[model samples]
Target: MSFTIAIIGRPNVGKSTLFNRLVGQKLALVDDMPGVTRDRREGEAKLHDLSFTIIDTAGLDEGPKGSLTARMQEQTETAIALADALFFVIDARIGLTPADRAFADFARRADKPVLLLANKSEGKHGELGAMESYALGLGDPIQISAEHGEGMGELYDAVSKLVPPTEDEDEEHEETDEERAARPIRVAIVGRPNAGKSTLINHLLGEERLLTSPEAGTTRDSIAVEIEYKGRGFRIFDTAGLRRRSRIEEKLEKLSVADALRAVRFAEVVVLMMDAQNRFEEQDLRIADLIEREGRALVIAVNKWDLMEAQPGQIAGLRRDADHWLPQVAGAPIVAVSGLMGEGIDRLMQAIVQSYAVWNRRVPTAALNRWFEGAIANNPPPAVSGRRLKLNYITQTKARPPSFVLFCSRADAIPQSYLRYLVNSMRETFELPGTPVRITLREKANPFAHKRKRPN
Candidate 1:
């Protein structure tokens, strides 16, 4: 296992910025608001020739027991326990506060190697704050501006002294391109606030790995957890619930929403969880539509099934409603899952595997062209402005959502309704249910257009 370090401090001390800097990617959400990050996030980080694991944690605070704030702190504590070292950060621009002093003691009690980071140390005031941080007795503060990429050399030196890389670790086999391609299937779970997304993921992992509470908007970052089911590996991302655009008033929420969207785009399959009681609302439909528009394989989970009164044909009814409300994603898998009780867990995982297969399915050219011929024979292109549109050959361009290209006499004359017809027909013909299918129409170039015709 790689050496792990946890960054912990009072809220808004540039911890996330430092994490992003180390990971070389903007994987975590960062904002001016304190406590924007509620859950702990892990990433593989590299500095110079050194490689290790880094964890970004929620801000340390004194929250009332059993409160959401307390749970956030609990998440931080969990990260601390998991880490081999600590990066105790403070905002150098504003100098140290009582909160920082208090958390300093908390770090000491962990009895692990702690590196004091005075972030935002890019000015005279910052230097003064770094000097003040020495009073905490952690050691000489490393003056670094995580945002500006300053003092990284000093940081590398400090971290090297604490945990030097071993030759065996350096000889460890690096994951190759083929290995990456065959890695775990990426899946993201998303829905409205308090839809039991976290609960479902926890149930899957058989542990309370993610911080969850009854309160809405407890999650503010897209947290990815890797797990296996029936010998297949999957990297599941639990995202912050997406609300209506107008309802997103705070900057932090907006950042969270953006992060969730990035996760959706990054994922190979997305599971949209909804409250079993209030499922299929307008917003739910909107989210489903958004996923289809993004061209990702989707699975709808009606969560909290235990709360609903089980009725005869309820499962069938759920299917009918899913198809009716969101025909764009027609034939998509719908599973009634109680994330709390682990009901329908096997079915959900099966659905995800099936959906991923469908998403990456590619059709043979011969079979595709044969279907095209039959489709045009059944209902040829309609005449527009007294001229019959000549439909030419069709070919499948790619698959991961099964897109195709159609050569026609007049591409501009093709109606969207006609395109929808072709999309539906191809979907039915190819057994591609619940996956987005794209078809592009191109006008065939006339062979004799350039030849000057003799006046007859």
Candidate 2:
């Protein structure tokens, strides 16, 4: 296992900014607002020749037990326990405060090697603040600017002293393209409140890692956990249940919803959980529509199957209803699952794998154009304002929810119904089901207009 480092600090201390710099990507959500990150996020980070895993944690703050902030602090403590080393960051511009001192004591109790980071250390005031941090008695503070990429060499030197690279790793090369491609697939579990989203995640992990209850909104922040299923790695993000916009009056709930939306945008596949008893409710349909609009691979998991009284055609009926209401994602895979009892999980996993494959599928251009020719011949594009529409060719522009562009004459003349027809035909013909398909029409210029026909 790689040496693990946890970056913990009070809110808005540039901890996330430093994490982004180390990982070389903006994987975490960064905002001017404090506590933007409510859950612990892990990433592989490299500094100079040193490679290790780094964890970005929620800002440490004291809160009443059972409150949302309290739960966020629990997440931070969990990261501290898991880390071999800790990066204690403070806002140099603002200088140290009671909270910084309080968290410093907290880190001191952890007994792990801790590195004091005086972030935003780019000015004279910052230097003065770094000098003040020495009074905390942690160690000499490393002055570094996370945003401007200054003082990284000192940061690297400090981290290296704590966790040195192994000799075996020194002889080994960097991760090849194929190894990188095999990284875990990101999946987000999302749905309405009390829809068994967290329960389902617990079942997959085979542990009560996520807090669950019968209450309507047990989950708040989007918590991501890594898992391995059938020799495949997946980083599953369990998101807070979404509710009607008008009903969300609490500021905290709104932030949680925003975080959940971010998880959906970042995920490769999303499992929309639904209560078996109250399946296909208005909120459920709305969430499904949002997922489709985001162009994500989707799997419908009707949870709590054990509670449902057995009916002869219950599964078939559920499938029919899903298809009828959610026509945008027509033919999406629906699996009946009991999160508490762990029934039908294998099939749900299979459906997710299949959906992900379809979302990433690419078709050959020649095959696509051939299918287009046949479909157009059977049901041609309608004439618009006395001019016949001509579709010259169709080609897939990209995949990961299969987008295509059709070069034709008078692109704006093509009706939405025609585009729908093409999308549906393409879906069926290309074996792509339960995935969003985008088709764009482009008008081809008429080159022959400059050479007028000679008067005969």
Candidate 3:
């Protein structure tokens, strides 16, 4: 394993800013609000020639036992334990507060190599704050502005002394044809609280990689794990159960929900798991709608199927309910699976793969326009303000959910119902089901209409 560094500080310090700078991406959500980060987010960081794994941790603070703050502190502690070194950041503008001193003692007691960073040290106040850090007895403070990308050379020098050099492999990232073609499929399992999302992932993994309990909201972070199912590589993200907005009072639970939403946004295929006994609830529909709106490939997994007694017409009823409730994903594949009994897992995986394939499907422009002409001929666009709306042509702009742009004379005049009709028609004609299809209307600019007529 490579050397790992953990960034720890009191609330509102520039830890996240430095983490984002090192990683060269805004992976962690940065906000002026204190305690924005509550979990340990890891990313590969490079400073000039040095490369190591950097962990962005939640602000260190004391809270009541079993509370959300306590859990966040536990996550930070975990990151501290995992790291070979630590970047203890302090807001230079504020100098040092009692909380900063307290956390400084805590970091020193951890017995890891600590790098003192006086962040936001761009002005006179910042310089004074950096000078005050010397009293903490960690080491000489590295005055730097994480936001402005200053003092990186000094920061690099400090890190270089602590961590050993690694052989450069910039070119090794080029993948072979076989390796490139066999990339892991990213799937996120999401559902309401106590819906057995963790149980389902544990069953698929054939081991307890996640902490599962009868208690609701056991998971508070979106955890990703890799597994191979039937020779196919899969990276599945098991997310925290989403409760109603009114029910979520704690700030930490809100962050957890946000993290789960990010996982959904990052995923290619989303498995919307639901308890078979209490299927198609209000929250379930909301989540399904969210998936559709995000334009992600979706698979509905009715979990805990083994618990429910087999009924003659139960399957048909479930199918009808899916179609009735979620018309947006009209033909989305639904599979019945028992995460505990390990039944119907193969079918669920197959459905996920199929949904992903559908999401990535593309239709030829010629065939698309041909179907468009036929669809318009069969049911012409409705007249707007006593003038018939003229649809010039249709062409797919992009794939991954198959977005199309329709050129028309009066684009704004076409009603939403008409667009819905065209989308449904395109879905049916192109054999596209379940995947979200986006249709954009564009008015062909009439150059001659603007020019004044020369004759009479």
Q: What alpha-carbon RMSD in Å does predicted model 1 have with respect to the real structure? A: 2.5
lDDT of 3 by residue, 342-396 (tens): 8999999998888887888889978987899999999999998899999999888
lDDT of 1 by residue, 1-456 (tens): 789999999999999999999999998898887888888999999888778899999999887998888988998999999999999999998998999999999999999999999999998999999999998999999999999899999999999986677454546788996796579999999999999999999999998888898889989899999898888899999999899998999888898899999999999899999999999998899999989989999999999999988689999999999989988888899999999999999999999999998898888899988888888899888899999998888888898888888998979998888888888887788778888988888888999999999999
TM-score, predicted candidate 2 vs. hidden true structure: 0.78
Off by over 4 Å in 2: 9-38, 45-51, 58-77, 89-109, 117-137, 141-156, 163-181, 213-221, 244-258, 364-370, 453-456
Q: TM-score per candidate, in order?
A: 0.94, 0.78, 0.72
lDDT of each: 0.92, 0.89, 0.88
Task: Pick the winner on TM-score between candidates 1 and 2.
Answer: 1
- Residue 243 alpha-carbon offset, candidate 3, angstroms: 2.0
Can you tell me which runs of candidate 1 are displaced by over 4 Å? Answer: 163-181
Cα-based lDDT at residue 42, candidate 1: 97
Ranking by TM-score: 1, 2, 3
The best candidate in terms of TM-score? 1
Candidate 3: Cα lDDT at 77: 88
